[model samples]
Target chain A: MNQLLFFAGLKEAAGTENVNMDLAGLTVEEVKKKVFEVYPSEQLQTSMVAVNEEFAGQEHKIEEGDTIAFLPPVSGG
Target chain B: MNGKQVWVTEEPLSPGEIISRVTRRDAGAINTFIGTVREFTKGKKTLYLHYEAYPAMAEKKLQQIADEIEKQWPGTTTVMAHRTGRLDITDIAVVIAVSTPHRDASYAASRYAIERIKEIVPIWKKEHWEDGEEWIGNQKETKPGVPTKEESR
Candidate 1:
């Protein structure tokens, strides 16, 4: 299982801050697909993902116990 | 023994505390900038400001800003602390302090740090006005005499 965290605007849009995905050896894209399946109305198209605190693209593979974060573009000063 | 020191907190920030952190015997010039919550905007009375951030990314971006300053000005000490959560009027929102042997370097680095922070850091501020609260984000194209919603449209 992997722990996923969402922050800022993404959290507000998703309506939940964090979730645990029980998909071992799945790619990041697969995880994102699961998220979309769970929240079909969510605006996941514009969000970005991070793995282990580093910005990651969709192709990045996820291992067991990995920490994933979904982030929306932030506007802060 | 060198490089930049950074601290990010949800507690209210104090300019005096930040100043004490970077002060050293070798530094001759220390420049600090404090961002505060204002009382009025567009004729609306503000109640408070709420700040939020992507903790990991914010900390990383702050470190990069400090590294850039160090490269531009050698032997410079920089400290930047931004507050999160709710803040009332007159509360310190952000504090940036830079120390250098000369005033020019201190001023330059301090200015650069604040500008870059506003540009790249993932922190958002929501202004709570008497009537309502509005989130201010991506002011990249803000212009005079243009209403925010009209501009978006």
Candidate 2:
């Protein structure tokens, strides 16, 4: 099982901070699709996905026990 | 070597402390950039601002920015801090300190750090106005490197 984390507005839209999904061997794009199915939102489309604290491209392969995060465009100074 | 060079904290950010971390004996110049909350933005009266972040990832990205600065401008030391939770008007929101052998590199690196934070760090701010509140950059039209709707207005 992989833990999917949400931050910023995505967290508010998802209604939770994180979720566990069985997502081994799936690509980051596929993970996004599966996650949206559970908590559908357009914000997820614009978010940048990260795997294990590093930004991941859509084709990046997911491994078991990986931690995934969805980050919206930042507004920090 | 305090190991607090890049951090996200709920407590108020101290510019003096952040500047001290980057101070080096060989550095002839140090540039500090402090971002503060204001009462008015885009003609709206902001009551306060609430900031949130993916703490672990935010710190990682901040360190990445510092690394990029050090690479781009060799011999430069950089430190950054961002305050989370609620911030009132005139309160410090973020601080970036850069020290280099010369003034030019120090200024450039400090500017680069702040811009990269907005571009890549996993921090977000929600503006509370008298009429309403919204998360900045959360709109579909608001993308990095593009002027946000509020900004364009």
Candidate 3:
């Protein structure tokens, strides 16, 4: 099972810090689309994805038990 | 030494501590940028700011920024520390410290560190206002009418 993590606004919108999914051979882009299906939000549309502590692109492949983090637009100093 | 270069802490950020990270016998100049929470944004009276980060990734990107600064300005070392959790107005939010043998390198390196953090760090902020509150997007972009889960209509 892969865990989908949400932060800040996305966490609130999804109503949970994380959700579990059976993601096998799914590209980051595919997983993103599925996330939208599960927890649709306008903010999630623009949220960037990260896999294993690195910013992941739509084309990046996901692995088993990997942590997929959905980050809303960053606003750090 | 690498992990020591960047941090995400819940303690009140100290610009001096960040500067201490780079102090060395050879360093003759140090440059620092301290970012503080303000009392107002646009016209809204900001009550406070709530900050969060993908901790592992935020620290990773902070190191990346430090590395980039080292490459661009030889002989310089960078230190970046960001505060997480709720921060009241006038609180110190972040500090980027750079040190080198001279002023020029430290100045440019410090500038590069802050800009790169804003562009790449996986951090988020929620602005609490007197009337309402909103989560600020990448680079603090705020949009009206977008509802949080609690207030979704």
Candidate 4:
């Protein structure tokens, strides 16, 4: 299972903070594709992805038990 | 290296607390920068500020900043703490403290910490003005030759 977390504006936009998916052998991009497929209208294009607390590009591989987090652009001063 | 120290909290951050964390007998100079929620911005009446973070990424980037400082300036200690959730006027939004053997190193490291944190850390702020609240992304006044949002990405 993969654990997905959303924060800030992305969380508000998704209307949920987290989800657990049972995709065992998918890459990070594939998981992102599935998330957008489920929430078709949500904006995933501009969000950033992280795996195991590290910033990751879409091509990174995802394994079972990895924690994935999506982050929107930061605006803080 | 003492390692990177980070605190993400909703309560007000104390300058003394942050100072204590980074202080060491080997370091003579310490520099700190405190970011507060101001009551005015461009003639608008600001009520409060709301801060949010991609907790995992924020912490990671903060550690990267700390590491970079240690690489650039040897024997310096750094600490960065940011408050999440709501903050009232005069409340510290973020605090950065650096200790070094010399004053210049402390200043440079502290400034670098804040600048890099702003540029890379996934922390966002919303200004709750009298009219409405608006998110302020990574937009800021830039120095010439420095990278813009598009350039950085």
Best by DockQ: 3
Candidate 2 residue lDDT tens string, B1-153:
357779999988878878889888999999999999989887889999999988998898898888888889999998899999999999999999899999999878988887677777789999998888888973334453323323211
Model 2, residue pairs in steric clash? none
- lDDT digits (tens) for residues B1-153 of candidate 3: 334889998888877666778889999998889999999777779999999988888988888788777888889988889999999989999998888999988878888778777767888889998788888885534332222322111
Worst 10 residues of 3 chain A by lDDT: A50-59
Could you tell me the TM-score of candidate 3? 0.91
In order of appearance, the predictions have TM-scores of 0.78, 0.91, 0.91, 0.84
Question: Residue B31: error of model 2 in Å?
Answer: 0.4
lDDT for model 2, on a 0 to 1 scale?
0.85
Q: Model 3: clashing residue pairs?
A: none
| Listed models, DockQ each | 0.23, 0.46, 0.48, 0.33
lDDT at B26, model 4: 96
In candidate 3, how many Å is residue A37 off? 1.0
Tens-digit lDDT track of model 4 for B1-153? 233497566777888988998889999999999988888888898899889887656777787888889999999888888888988898899999899999989989988888887777878888897778876754644332223444233
Best by lDDT: 2
Predictions ranked by DockQ, top down? 3, 2, 4, 1
Instruction: State the iRMSD of every prediction, in order shown.
Output: 8.1, 5.0, 7.0, 5.2
RMSD in Å for all candidates: 6.7, 4.7, 6.4, 4.4
Error of 2 at A64 (Å): 0.5
- Top-scoring candidate (TM-score): 2
